[model samples]
Target: MINDKSFIHYLKEAEQDFSGWDFSYVTDTGRMAASLLSWSYGSMAKKLITEATSLLDMGTGGGELLAKLQPFPHSVFATEGYKPNFPISKKRLHPLGVTVVEVDEDNLLPFTNGQFDLIINKHEAYSAQEVRRVISENGIFLTQQVGGADCAEINEALGIPLNQEYLHWQLDFAKKELEDNGFRVVFAKEETPVQRFYDVGALVYYLKAIPWQIPDFEMGDYMEQLYGIHRKIESKGYFDVTQERFIIKAEPI
Candidate 1:
């Protein structure tokens, strides 16, 4: 039974609080581990910033990743759609001279056309046309996206179907979308990396944090599946899942 003493004990451990696009509670503590990717977006961004006079960071969650990728260009901006992250990003980025904007739709950017020389997005949804419209002719658009198959193993283990709408979102689809929208892809790569969770609670906490992972996720509804996974983890040491990831670097055609 999931209500057993041991199950409850680990569930309590998984309830540890986290905030601001940060997952250090699990990641830093060794409760969860993800394999590394071949490329580093931060390193690439750092190099590009030196030559860029204007920059935009799309969906800058809590401004944490943006903050890390700084010494920014003269005109730097970040957009976040999530309301709870607005104040958090503002507090962290304002002092750094970034203009944090609240955006409602991925297709409707508030900035004027040809406004930015460098635009970067990490694990964020974006519209190809909107991005092409905003970037200068000589500008660069670099993004790392989570593929439709991201963490599908979790859904499979829980007997849930993968989200159909995003099932075809991968490097090929994104590259074609950009090309059709007047951008030439300069670099693109995709990889499936392994992510291992040491306990069931870590997975619960993760799914809770990322609602889209299991929309309408309720602990009560998933108790049996959770217990099954818990038992598996206890027997196997960890539950492993392959996550889909891809990166694209493009320029206006």
Candidate 2:
């Protein structure tokens, strides 16, 4: 078990603001590492954007990634469902002529039918029907999703029950869903990359940043498990977990 002083220090640092979708603070510290998928989501999206007259980026957190793909199409739009990220996305994307729109989680996209020729979604939730409605007949939809069974090893290490919500969220299910909604599956791939945390602080920060990983993740409630994992990390140099991810490209039929 880590000492009281070290434990407190880690907890305090992990509790800092996690605004936007940025994870550089923990990742750059050399305490966390993960494997990459064979395909590149950014490169594919950028290439498609260059070929399209209009484009939409869904769930653009703080518009960080979108801003990087400069020299955008004449009509560039982005939607963010999370309230806190709306202003941040606007501040970053507006100067680049990208319109940042705030959207309700339950409502349809606030755009006319067949508005965009290309739509890109990275780690975001989307409605298949809504995507079909807004996209042009020949439009392309490219998305990279965090699969439901991601980080099962973390739950195992913590001695917590696995969350059943994402048990069937595989590549096959995603492809079938899009096909059912009038999309022809073009490219689909899934990978379970191993992620390693070299320190307890990195693990805590990751879980805090992604609350859905463990809904009731209270430090007090899981102190024993945390310490056990900490001991393992101290001995083995890292704690490893598999992360589920998938990417798909579909065109409306």
Candidate 3:
């Protein structure tokens, strides 16, 4: 049901300017595109999703997946680190009896131990230790990450290369860190790469829109760089960009 056209509209609406302390542009659009491009969490969690009393939709944005999961026999609590989207999510989930928690990336979540039966995150910055700290012993933690090792391919296609060394090693380190944190890994699958679109203008728009990704980099001057890449890629009708993602499910021990 998700297509490129709908994604464009979602991007446009999500980029709309908002004023407040809860402003996180990248978390908003990034999560949406990640969800639409692939439902890695839903597919991975399908087998494990059973009747639970409560579930936490970590990094919930646009409320799309959370909304879809609302019909289950559980109370859904949505958490978003992006401040601006928190109010928007609250408005949407209030009528549906979902609680919205505004999370701060620098601080631990304001929840007691063993608060949720299921914790899910798609494109979130949480590490395995963080998930293990708050989840109940029997609870499950599901994540769909940006596949740290293979991210360069997509960056090259986007004309924005990340200046990181040993990216793949970092992902492996993360896996080890999670296992060290008392989580037993259940499933770990990497999704096949898929194509995504961003016209020259959209690409430039996104650079400015998601400052968190390239905070120190000056995007204005990069317009030319992006345009050049866009022209070269678009000349062939479409950019052959692809993103590799990882789906992981673990349970606290």
Predicted model with the maximum TM-score: 1
- List the global CA lDDT of all models: 0.92, 0.89, 0.61
Between candidates 1 and 3, which one is better according to lDDT?
1
**Per-prediction TM-score, please?**
0.97, 0.95, 0.74
Per-residue C-alpha lDDT of model 3 across residues 93-180, encoded as one tens digit per residue: 7678788888886138777778888888877777566677778889888877775544354356446656565355344565676789
Tell me the lDDT of candidate 2: 0.89
Sequence-dependent TM-score of model 2: 0.95
- Runs in model 1 deviating more than 4 A are none
Q: What would you estimate as the lDDT of candidate 1? A: 0.92
Give residue 244's lDDT in candidate 1 (0 to 100). Answer: 93
Where does candidate 3 stray beyond 4 Å?
1-39, 46-50, 72-74, 149-171, 216-219
Query: Over the stretch 1-253, how does candidate 1's per-residue lDDT look in tens digits?
Result: 5457777787777776656698888888898999999999889888988789999999998999899887888999999999888999999999999999999999999999999999999999999999999999999999999999899989998999999999999999999999999999999999999999998888988987898989999887888888989999999999999999999999998
Please give, for residues 140-229, the per-residue lDDT of candidate 2 as tens digits.
999999888899989988888777877888889999999999999999999989999988888998888787889878887888888888
TM-score of 1: 0.97
